[model samples]
Target: MRLHEHQAKKVFKDFGISTPEGKVVNDPDDAEKIAEEINSPVVVKAQIQVGSRGKAGGIKFAEDPKDARKKAKEILGKKISGIKVKKVLVEEALNIEKEYYVGFTLDRGSGKPVAIISSRGGVDIEEVAEKTPESIAKEELDPIWPLHDFKARKLAFKGNIRKEAIQEVSRIAQTLYKIFTDKDATLAEINPLVLTEQNQLLAADAVLNIDNNALFKQPELAELREETEEDPLIRKAHEYGFDYVRLDGNVGVVGNGAGLVMTTLDLIDYFGGKPANFLDVGGGAGSATVENALDLVFQDPNVDVVLFNIFGGITKCDEVARGINEAIEGRELPVPLLVRLAGTNYKEGLKVLNDEKLRVVSDLEDAVKEVVKLAGE
Candidate 1:
């Protein structure tokens, strides 16, 4: 799950983070009204989930209400990064003297949240890390303790923040950590945390990605998800109650566990073929779930072959075979299926697949070679 800029800003404002005063508008008149209410030089910014709105001409500056209306008309309904600009955030424009980057994300190696601050901002962090690695300051904090005042102060000093701004930055970092933890967010980023001419700090732009597993606790945040920019097959997979990620290959994979699905992908690649998608039916998948997974895989024109690798422990391989049989009988499969069944009821599972006239293999390497050869033909 991911929250749009407007929703993320709402969280920031609630946590005492100073942000540009803005209101969302759906039309030119609404933008004009907001401009009048603010009574300042306003910026009309398209509200889409994708980045680089500035490069895509989705952001426009207006000196007055007339220009604001014109900018809104030009932006509304226009596509930016393939997403139609349905709403615009009309915000008071500020004169920025300096820009900084502030973000909190999980450090995979450390297995904890890491707070990153950089003086060089408003550009891709990856590029900055590769080109000028020294500019970014990172502080890995304990999950139980999270960010502390001492660590926050240390980060400020490392980032070369001014003495006067040290306290403010420290406080901002603390609040940001709260936002990150309390909301169950995987990433909370504010690019170009700007310093205004008046010497006030504000967040000029924001991006947040929430942990999908934690959406049950954050219903309000989940509402901010934009489905238009998402892969069609992926969206459909979710709707059908399965996990799917569209990949760039021809082998379609269906498995019960995450590890098995990954191995399936790797084996396909090992045999000179790329995986078309990663579809995990999850434990206890029934006939309906299996049918839906097959539907999604066959929908992909890129998929020439399907692979079902089932390692049934808590998830019975026999049940998975039944689902596979149900799917094959229910729909016109556009591609061939190569199945490898192991663990509980492996023999029974193999019997079911063989009965369906589906290609069955016991060895993963041999299955990969056969599938790759079949797809290439």
Candidate 2:
């Protein structure tokens, strides 16, 4: 669950991290009013979840109230990275002396929360890593111990921050760590943490991605989720008790578990095919659940083929087969489907799907190759 810039800034404010004064407005008139109230050069930023808003022409500088309205009109209702910009964040622009990047996220390899600081800001961290790895500093926080001010200060020093700004940078780092842990966030970031002309630090931009599994405990954060930012199929999958993630590919993948689904996606790529989505029907999926999963996969127009890799343990293979046949009973499915059923009533399931039009391969590798071939056709 990714929070919009305004929502992330709200969370940052609660933790004593300063952000530029901004108001979220859906209307151009409201944006103009906010800019007039600020009475300074303001930035109109699209509120879409994806990045590169500036490159997409979703971000514009408004010299005054009238210009703000013009910029808002140009931004609103525009699509950035395929998401419609229904709202924009109008903020008082800052005069920055320098910019830095500060972020806290879980390091899966280390199995601990890691803090990353870089002198290079306003760009993707991955780019920094690829070009100038030494410009960034990283530290892993102990799970039992809180992120101490001293440790954050040390990290700032390591990042080669000037002595005058180290204290503010350290403070911001500590607050970011707090937000990451307290809110059950997978990522909390402030790109271009800027030093103003007055020598004050502020987060010019903010991003927070919460752990969906922890949303139950953080109702307030959960409420900040913008459903419009999500793919329709993903929302529909949630309603049907399945986990689905959309991807840019042509082959639709479905499996019984997360690990299996991930492996299937890799295999599709290895076979010179791209996966359209990751669909996990869970361990105990019934025929109805399988039908719903198939229906959801077919909803994606990019999907040229559907591949089912079911190593059923708790979910019987026959149930999955029945669901697939039932889903394609009357409707003419434009895309071909390939099924691989290896465990739990495999023979019975194979017998159930013995139709000549339906392609069934018992071997996983063979199934992937078949799907790749059919998708290409």
Candidate 3:
């Protein structure tokens, strides 16, 4: 889950990391009060989940309490990256001597937690990597022993952080790694970890995104989740016990397992078809589960066509076929269905799905190709 900057800073503080004093406010008047409390030049930042707030005018510096109020008024009702800003963070502004970046995130390819450090900060890391790859230093950490001072120091040294600040930055790196692991976070980043004019290192901006699947262990962080920010279809999918993720494409995919769903999505991509969503019904899904998955996919307005890839094992292909039949007969679905049934009862599924509306394909590759072509990929 994405935490607003104010919430992320609180988590940083909880981990003994230094951060600029800040408070989250829903009202412009409260922003003024918070700035007055700080009694200094403050940064009035809109509390939205997406980044590039500064570029979008979601972040503004306040000269004083009155300016803070005015800035908050301008930001609170504004939209950043298509998300309406409901709150703002009033934070003490800092005089920066230098800026650095530190983060701990999963490297899915390596199946490891990667520690990243850079001398450059307050900018998109992707932009840095794209334009100047040498500016970033990354170390893939062992999951059992994620990060140590030596490792962080090595990263700091490689990233060319200042000599005097290397030790402190390394310490912060270790702490950030600890938070990454302890919180089951998918990403823990401190961008623009500023070295103030006073020679104090503080995390000027904090970003912590915990894994939603691990939220069971992080009750406090779970409370920080904004349900309203979630897509209604995704929330419904979760409620219905389906592992789902909405994507930006036209073809909708549903499979029995995560690996299967992922493979289907990859094939769609390879075939030049954009996948609209990833919906995994899990193993042992019955007829009702199949229908539910279809219903969920059908709810997506972006889906031009729906593809089902089911390799029946514990879940019998016949039950899945029955579910498809029931769902199709019950309603005239807006999008056409492309069904691929393999493994046990494959023949029975093929026989059952004689409906003119269902385009049943026995081969996974053939099904993907057909669906992509039909979706105008």
Candidate 2 structure, TM-score to reference: 0.80
Q: Write candidate 1's Cα lDDT for 243-312 as tens digits.
A: 6777667888888878789888888887799888889988877767777887788888888998888887
Which pairs clash (backbone N, Cα, C closer than 3 Å) in model 3? none
Q: How close is candidate 1 to the true structure, as a TM-score?
A: 0.67
Q: Which one is best on TM-score?
A: 2
TM-score of each: 0.67, 0.80, 0.74
User: Considering lDDT, where higher is better, how would the candidates rank from best to worst?
Assistant: 3, 2, 1
RMSD of candidate 2 to the truth, in angstroms, is: 3.8
Error of 1 at 78 (Å): 1.8
**Of models 1 and 3, which has the larger lDDT?**
3
Query: What lDDT score belongs to each candidate, Candidate 1 first?
Result: 0.84, 0.89, 0.89
Candidate 3, residues 1-377, lDDT tens digits: the string is 77888888998999899999889899999999999999999999888776678988999999999999999999988866446788898999999999999998998888999989999888988878878778899988998985877888889999889899999999999999999999999999999999999999999999999998899999999988887765667768988998888776899999999889999999999989999898999999998998888888988877999999999899889889999998888578798899999998888888888568888888899999999998994
